[model samples]
Every structure is written in structure tokens, then in C-alpha cells.
Target: MASSLTKDSATPAPEKTFLGHPIGLATLFMTEMWERFSYYGMRALLVLYLVSGGADAATGSQGGGLGYTAAISTAIYSVYVALVYLMAMPGGWFGDRVWGARKTVAIAGSVIMVGHVALALPGQISFFVGLLLVAAGSGLLKANISTMVGHLYKGVDDPRRDSGFTLFYIGINVGAFAAPLVIGTIGETVNWHIGFLLAAVGMGIGLLVFLLAGRTLDPKSSQVPNPLTPAERKAVIVKGLAVAAVVAVFYTAVTMAGMFTIKWALYPITIAGLIIPVAVLVRIKRDKDLTPGEQGKMSAYIWFFVAAAVFWMIYDQGGSTLSLFGDKNSERSLFGWEVPTVIFQSLNPLFVVALAPIFATVWVLLARRNREPSTIVKFSVALAIVGASFFVFAIPLSQTAGNDTKVTMWWLVLIFLMHTVAELCLSPVGLSVTTKMAPQKYSSQMMGVWFLAVTAGDCITGLLGLAEVKMNGVGVILFQAAAAALAGLAIYMYRKKVDALVEGTK
Candidate 1:
């Protein structure tokens, strides 16, 4: 008799625990982990290094900065992040139509390595070119890897699906946690170029792993299931070109971020980028009927995106405002050894490693009791925890005198601990939600869309970090608190509608 689970029969059955946890799953996990390490390692230092000039001295306040000004750095960071996710949508499309996931991932990895190498170069032009390359590679690679993971499981309901993704999720954080200590320390304390070079090395490892595994795993692993005919391919190419042209024109007009200008033009463009997808989702519901079951699943995805944006906005402060906070405002000595402000970036991932299993167990127990919170509820909690952590900065803000006050290292630890709890509630589950909810035919595209929320949130964090520099430490703390509150309220209010949408589809 056939097994009750459809996934059991979805493909040629493999023995249990192929290479310790299903061959396909293991491969994707390793690849993503290394990629995240490179990405997060850079992120861990980007804001701190920029705002503080360098990471050596404990210059906590705006007074201690390198002098380029926070506004300029924030603008550069925002544009870089925005472009990163923006590239992903097309990257996914390219993989689906022409190259397939494995090849696309390899190509993207190679490109990213080159970008990191460029960042290691010592010129403004190289910096710009490196960032551009990194963004392009991220766009191309991020979505495809997750889609490949889903393909490994064969069907959405596979019993191994959750565990497979869980393992993969762990990989993401492992790299994130390690980057700060390894790359951040070297870059800030020793040489900035060292960190960039390390990032390139991480990408190289990821590329090698993916290339080797692609050949040994499923024969159909990289095959495009649906090939477009000439006319259809032509139409897609035209649409892509048109979108690129329009976005390029829009970018050109508002491209004054380098000059520290946040123009009105960005508002409409950002809005449209978000709204167009919602419009497509609505159309899918109204015209396509898209099964209430499927609609509900996808609504969960939208909620995940919003909630994640909130969580990341706060979580990402580690590299931006928080780094500055640690530098000038907080006390940083431990057993006669002074800690580099950028090194604090390691806390969240460190906490993740320590706390992930606890949260996972709570979830499993809750699932057993049939009392698990909906994805939306968990996300709300994540936002609340993330937002609440900023209040801790307020204490230091009041105590410090632009670098005179010595705040305890424990305070930074406390804030990261809270953010860690919040992340545990959000990040891993968010990845799973996206993978499960999106249609198989559009898996990577939807994942790309989901990542756009992260990109947007990172941009917001940079903007707010700059605002903190301008308005003073207290102003930054209050701004973050307000954003978190707003995001939490929005999620709670919309919970029912979103829950219904997910339920109807499921």
C-alpha cells in the first residue's frame, strides 16, 4: 500500500538520512549558510566602520565619528540594500527560464566573490563596483537556493520538509554569528580589507560546495520543468527589459543618495514596488480563485514579510546605531581587554545558536498541544521583542556624554538577548512560511519577493540610524520604539483577516 503522506511517493525514494539529512537538503543548507556568513559578516561591520570612521577607539557618540557624516553613510547603505533584493526578482526569473537553480547559484556565487574582492580594493570606484556586483549576485542567488530546497523535498507536505528547512535555517545563522568575530574583528581592528577578503573566501567555499553537489544529486535537480517557446520567451524578455528601463530611469533621477538626498521620487517608486505584488495577489484571488487554502497560505507569507521587515529593522541596528552606541556612549572594558564596538554584532547570532533549540522545542510542544500560535502571532511577538530592546539604548543615552560615560558591556548583551528571542520567533519560521506558501511553479519568485521586505527593512534601519546621529542618541531610541509599536499594532489588527486568508487557502 502507498504511504499516507503524498511526499513519500513524490519521487524515487531515497534511504533515510542521505548524507546525514537527505542529500538535497544538506547541500542547500551548506550553500546558504556560507552565503549568509559572507553577507552578514559584511553587514556586521558596514555601518559601524562607516559611521565611526574605524572601529578601534571606543567612540560611542556622533562626536567620535570619522567625519563623512551619518547621513551620507546611511544613504549609501540604503541604496545598496534596496538594489540587493531588487535584483533577486529578475534573478529568480532568469533561473526559471534559462539556467535553472544550480547553474544560476554558481554563477551568482562567482560574481559575489568578485564583488567582495573588489571591496577589498582601496578605491571609491572599486567600492561602488563591488557593491553593485554583490547586489546583483544576491538577487540572482538568494531565491533560487530556497526553491532548490523545496524541490529536494518533492512536495510541500513532505514530512522532512520542516526539519530540512530547520537545518537550512541553522546554517544561515551559523554564518551570521561567526562573521562578526572572524571578519568584523579583523576588518575593524586590523584592516578593513581583511574583512572584505574573508567575505570573498566564504563565497568561494559556498560556490565549490554547490558545484560539487549539483552533479551527484538528483538528475533533474537543475532541469527547467517548463521551458518557454520562442514567442513566450520573447515576451518575457521584453517585459524584463521594459521594467529595467523604467527602474533605471527612476533610479537615475533619485540617485542622489551619494549626495545625501532623500527625494520625493523614491516614495512612489517604493510604494509601487510593494503594491504591484499585492495587486497581483489580489488578482490571483479574485480571478484565479487560487483556492482559499492556497490564498490563506500566501496571506501568511505577506504577513511574514511585514513582520520580518519590522524585526530586521530593529535587529539590524546591531551594525548601525548600536555599533555607534557601543563605541561612544557605552562602557566597553572586560577583564582589562577593550572590546571593539563592531564586535558586538556577534551577539544576535551567538544568542541564536544558544536559544534556537529552546524556541524550536517550545514550538514543537505547542504543536503537539494544538495550541501553536499562528505565524502572524509569532511575528507580532517578534516585533514587540525587537522594538522593546531599543529602550535599553535610552538608558545609555541618558548616562553617556558623547563618549565620556562607560556603559557596561552587559547592556549590549541584554539587548542582543532580546533581539535573539525575537529572531527565534520570526526568522526561521519566516523562511519556512515562504517556502510552503508559494506555488511550486513560482517558488523562487515568491521567495525573492519575501526577501524584498528584508531589503526594505535594512534600508529603513540605515535611514533611522542616520537620523539618530542627527537628532542625538535619545531621538534615535524613541524613533525605533515608535516604528516597532506601529508595526506590532498593524500586525495585531490585521491578524484575523490574514489568518482567515491563510486558513481558507490551506
Candidate 2:
């Protein structure tokens, strides 16, 4: 797959630009940084806003929450997160099959901004509408953006590729780290609507940065990696639109009929999430066009994706369940200042920022001696780390008398550190390998499929929120930790088989 690129954008970049990576890194780095700030900032406020209606009646809520029960709020969170990942499939397909990644990203960013703006408005209609837009837009932007990062590197085996992704991940954290400090504080202390407005402004800035700097990225990023014929393009577009329209109508009818609420929306969302990747896998496995090696790579890729999703299912709680824990259970005051609970959401990104470079360097060093862990092995490590974090977090539960009792900050801090280590082991590796393993013709689409791991996990997370474990009790935490650990270990035990399946990729 080659890009139809402009000459100016394709000019040979200096080898040592942007801390020894391509010049394009600066462009994507800033864009992703601000986008993440917008995302995490808004996410930090969601559950809090949902649950705040029950906050101290005397003092009143900063913006008065939606007054939902924990289960309902968490269900909404799970669905939104799941949709964001699930939508990326078509978003990736659109980029690969129709509009170029550059255009897809720009359009998606604009749509996301619209979502944020709508969220700034009060009322349930605007709220759900806003979440829908943001999820759809994010789906389009994310996989394509990550794909563009891979395009900047020289080749599949490029030594700097992992490092570049790590740096990009760092850019993600820069925004994530600051969002809580800025957006979290204001949203918690002042007004929820104001906080949402700030998120919109942040995305607007991100879009502007992307337009200005992204132009300097490899021109190949602007062209479809695999160009389609006129007939193919028309067929895909028409079918996509028709299918989307029908689904939208059916969904709306169900909702307006009172047979559906935001909570029940998960049924469709989860079905879509599972179906997209499975369909893609079927396509890959059955495609006569692919060589045997390509088929093996796809199988291995699926295993890694499943493991990554398991890790994410645990890691994602940072925003949903762990968030409420920080707000209600963890001690919020630091040196006499009342800390906004949202600030705790910053911990994982903060750890990623501090640790990513070290991990990148370690991988580079290990690769020199052929000592680096295979992608699958790293995934196992990630699962163990996150599972352990939960177990550690759960240990203190026996001491607390009530859900609101304050636990020490180190308990949460330790968990973030553990989760961050798990993330480092998995996130950058997954991003780098997806581009490497995908068949060239379907590269972008495959990247989107890979995100189905998150899609599956998020769907399950929503359902899990409705379960007894929504807020971690001793039983819930222990079971979750054990399940993830066992899953990781099971994968690790099959490392030899998984490695053989991906030999062509390596």
C-alpha cells in the first residue's frame, strides 16, 4: 500500500528530527496531546456529574449531577467507551476505502468538537446526542491517527518505530495529565457546563494544531493506503450509508417507544462491537488473496488483541469505578487543599509520561541483543501487572467501615503505577504491531479491527457495571484480579504457538 502524496510533504525528513524521530512526530504529538486533554478532561467529569445530585444537600452540587444510581451512570460510561472503540472499525474502513486518512481525521475532529459543544448544553436529549457524536467522531480519528504515526517510520522493522509510538503515547498523556488539573478543578469547583465548554475549546485547539502541523507529515498519510476503483468506492459508500440510516432509524424508534433507554442501548452497541472484528477475522481467514503466512499473522494478531482487551477491561476502570472510589473512598485533601477527585484520574497518564521514555529505551537496548520480549509475552506481563494492582487495591477494603471511608493516597498511587507499567507493556507494543501485522491492502481497516479488543472489553464493562462488582467490594476485586491474571498466564503458556503464528510478521 502506497500513499498518493504531494511532493512537498514527502520530502526526505532529517533523521534526528523531533528527538531523533521523523519531523511529523511534532505534528501528531501536539494534535494528540490536545485531543487527549479534551477527552480525559470530559471523561473525568462524567460519572461525577452523574452521581453528584446526591452530594451533600446543604452545600449543594457544584453543577448538581444527573441523579442517577451508580449502575446507571456506569452503564452509560461503558456504552460510550465501547461505542468509541466500535465505531473506529468503519472509521478505519472509510479512511482506507474512501476518504484519505487526512480528511477523515479532520472531519472526525470537527464532529467531536460538535459533540463537546452539545454536551455543554443542559438536558438529557443533548447529553445523549453529544455522547453519540463524540463516540462516532473519536472512532474515526483514533485508529487513523495511530496509523499515520506508523507511516512516519521507515519500515515495519524500523527500530525507532516502537520509540516513536511511545513518544506519541507520551503526547497522549501530556493532555491527559493536564486535563484533570485544569478541567477537573474547574468542573468540580465551579460548574459542570463550564467544564464541558472547556473540553470543547480544547478540541478546537487540537483541530487547529492538526491542520497547521499535520500538513507537514508524510504526504502518504493524505492518500488512501489502498486506492479503490470507482465502482468499488460507489458500492461501499452506498451500502454504508443505507445500513447506517436503517440502524439509526430502528434505534430511534425503539428509544422513543419507551422500549429503550440509554442503558438498553448497550444491546446494539455490544452486538456491533463483537460483530465488526469477528467479521473482519472471517474475511481474513477466508480470503483467498492472502498467503498462508498472512493468515497465520492474523490469527496471532487476534490472540494479542484478546489479551490486550482483557488488560484494558481492568485498566479502563481508572475512569469509571476507580474514579468513584477516589471521590468517595480515597482521601482527597493534600496539604489542606481540597483535591478534586478527578485529579486522581490523571495518575495513569502521569505515570505513563514518566515511564514511557524509560520503557522505550529499555526496548531499544533489548532489541540490540535480541533480548526484547515478543509482543505476546509483553501482553502477559501487562495483564499480570493490572491484575495485581486490583488485588493490591482490594486489600485495604477490609479495613474501611463504609464505602465513603478514606483510604491512603498510596493505595491508589500504587495501583496507577502498576496499571501504568501494564500499559507500557501493552499499549505501544499493540500500536506498533498492528501496523506491522496487517495485510498491506487492508492496513488501516485492520488497525481499526485491532481496536475491537477495547470494543469487546467496553461492552462487557458496561454489563459488569450492572453486576455486583460495579463498585469494588472484596469479592468483586479478588475475582477480577484472579480472572485477568489467569487469562494472562494462559496466554503466556501458549507463547510458543503464538510466536510461530506471527513469525512472518517479525
Candidate 3:
């Protein structure tokens, strides 16, 4: 699977530079920054808007919400986010084999802008349509734009590659950090639709930047790496339509049967999320192209995948469970002015921006001393730290149960800080390991496999939110904390076996 990321050694490097890297870096940086602004901006409001009741006729209070229950709102949020990631696989495929990276990104960005516009419109039909469009568009744009960034570098061994990615990463967090403050404030205080319109404007700016400056990007990025033959293209179209037909028929049948409630709708998605990864792993293991050593590494990668899924299941609760808690249970008063709940959503990215470099330096210092933890150990530590963060929250919730007391905002801040630390340990290392351990023949597909972990984790998070609503919230948090900690311990117990299977790839 040749990709835009794989540079041709024979091609000459570009001479024009920006910030000591290719000039195209700036184009991509700005584009991704604003794209994230749109994404996180809307995300900050999604659940809050869904659960809000616009105004109480009796009390004359200001409110503009759909008034869905917490469980339903969380479930919708989970499905929306899960589908966003799930689209990455096909998005990458379209970039690599059909439209090429640059074109796919340009088209996808346009779609995303339109999606945001739809979201800004009034009515439930428009809201649902907007979610679908944004998910589809984001799926296409996210992976391909990152691919374009890699294309800017000369090759795998480019000395500036890591630094370039670091700069690119900062763009992501910058957008994420700023979005909630700007969009959240407006959405919570004024109108949710207006906030969504602002998100549209953000994406529009990204698209304009990309369109004007994209020519500076590597020309190879515009070349389809594996152009399909006309016959193959027709076959793909036929297969796609067949799949769409099957889905439409199934949906119609379920709707007619009156078995298509929100909870029931989630069952199929959760089942698919659980099953797809197992099927992918089985297929990879059965591939005759892999050597026995590669097969062993595949087995080891499965462990890492499971650990990552567990990690994201807890970490992504920041948007659903954590956001809800912030809105309902956290004290928002500051100088007699109430703060918006969505502002707390900014904390994770804020911490990520601040802590990433420090963690990088620590890793380097540890490596120089030959005292760096192994990949498995780092993963175990991440799970434990994140789980413990929740445990920390659980204590406060348990003590405050059945009372009107609101916890201080500092508690949520502390949790975000801890989550950032765990992310640094696991997320980047997980990406590095996926590339290192994947069988050469299936490398591109392995990236898709990695994203499936996120999909699976999010699906599980939605299901757990329902459970949290039904059972005691404090008890559910304690159970999740215990489960995560035990998962970490299990990984540690089998560390030696995993290390052997990985065969020194790390």
C-alpha cells in the first residue's frame, strides 16, 4: 500500500521553507488548526445543547435545549464521534487510491463547511443531517491532511520530520484550546445555532487557506498512489451501492417493526465495534504473506490495541460524562459571574499544549540514561494513571452524593492534567508501535486497525453512560476505575511474553 506519506527517494526536496521546514507546513498547519476549531467548537456544545430545555414557561428562565435525557444525549454524542473516526479508513483509501490527498482534503473541507452550516440551521432534521455530514467530511479530511503533512518531508529519515509533526501537533491543541472558550461561551449564554454558525466560519477560513496555498504542497501528494483501473472503479461503485441498499433496507425494516429506539439502534453499532477488530486480527494472522516472526508481532500488537481501547474508553469520557458532571455538579461561579460548562472542555488540550514538550524532554533524558520504560510498561502506567484520575473524582462524588454541594472547578482541572499525562504516554507511542510492528504487506491497513480501537472504545463509553444513568453514578465510576487498574495490572503480569513476541521492535 504505497501512500502519500512514502516519499520517492529520487525526487528532489523543495527549497522554499517556512519556520525551518517546507513552506507547505504553514498551509497545512493553518488548515488543520481551523478544522479542529470547527470540530471541537461544535463538540463542546453537542451534549449540552441536546439536553437543554430552552425556557421554562413557568419560571421564565433562559434555556434553548432539545431536552433529551442524559443517556440519550450521551449515546448520540458517542455515535457521532465514533463514526467520525470510523470514516478515517475509507477516507485514507480515497486519498491514496482515488482523489489523491490534496483533492480529497479540499473536497472534504468543503463538505465539512456545509455540514456546519446545516448544524446552524433550526430543526431536528437539519441537526441530524449536519451530524452525518460532518462525520463523513471529517472522516475524509482528517487522515488525508495528516498524510499531506508527511508528504512535505523528504523521506522517513528526514531530520526535521519529528519537529514538523510537533509543530503540527501544536496547531491541533491551539485550535482545541481556543474553541471552547469562544464557541462554548456563546452557545451556553446566547444561541447554540449561532455558535454552530461560528464553527462553519472557522472551517470556511480553513478551506480558503488551503485553496489559496495548497499549490505549495508536494506535487506527488496530488498523484494517486494506486490508481484503480476503470473496471475496478465500476466494481467498487457497484459494491458500495449494494452495501448502501442493504443498510437502507435493514433500517426500514427496523423502523417499521418499531424496534428502532435510540437504545436499540446502538446495539448494532456496539456489536460491530466489538467484532470488526477481532475479524481484522484474524485475517492478518491468517495472511500467508507474513513470516512467523511478523505473525508473532501481530499477536503482540493485539495486546497493545486492547490496552489502547481501554485507555480511550476512559479518556474520551471528558466529552460525555465529564462534561455533564461539569455542567451539573461543578461550581462555576467566579467573581459573581457564572462560567459556562463547556469552558472546562478546553482544559485537556490546554494541558496537552503545556505538558507535551516537558514529557518529550523527560523521555529523552530517560533514554540517554538507558532507563526508559519499555512500551508495555508505559502503556500500563497510562492505564493506571487515567483510571486513578477517575478514582480521584469518584471520592468527591461519593462524598457529595445526595447533597446540593458542587465540587470546585479545580477537581476537573486536576483530572484533565492527569488525562494529558496518560495521553502523552500512550497515544504517540501507540502510533509509533503500530508502524513498527505491522506486517510490511499490511502496513496501511494497520493504521485503520489502530483507529478501530477508538471506535470500539467510544461505543463502549456510550453503553456505559446508559449504565451510569441507571445505576449509581458514583458506583459506576468506582467500577470503571477498578476495571482500568486491573487491566493495567494484567498487562504488567504478561509483560515478558509481550516483549518476546514484539521481538525488539520497540
| lDDT at residue 123 of model 2 (Cα atoms) | 85
For each candidate in turn, the TM-score is 0.81, 0.87, 0.93
Q: Highest TM-score, which number?
A: 3
Tens-digit per-residue lDDT, 181-234, candidate 2: 998889888998889889999999999989988757888888986678999878
| Highest lDDT scorer | 3
Ranking by lDDT: 3, 2, 1
Off by over 4 Å in 1: 1-19, 23-26, 52-67, 154-159, 235-305, 401-403, 432-445, 462-472, 493-501, 504-506
- The residue pairs in collision within model 3 are 52-65, 54-63, 54-64
How would you encode candidate 1's per-residue C-alpha lDDT over 9-33 as one tens digit per residue?
A: 6878557464455676767778888
TM-score of 2: 0.87
Instruction: Report each candidate's C-alpha RMSD, comma-separated, in the order given.
Output: 6.6, 5.7, 6.0
Give each model's whole-structure lDDT.
0.72, 0.81, 0.85
lDDT, model 2? 0.81
Q: Which scores higher on lDDT, 2 or 3?
A: 3
Clash-forming residue pairs, model 2: none
Would you list the rank order by TM-score, best first? 3, 2, 1
Query: Which regions of candidate 2 are displaced past 4 Å?
Result: 1-25, 54-63, 147-167, 212-218, 224-241, 248-257, 364-371, 401-404, 439-441, 466-469, 504-506
Write one digit per residue (lDDT tens) for candidate 3, span 297-370: 99899899989888988888888778877777778788998878889889989888888889889989999999
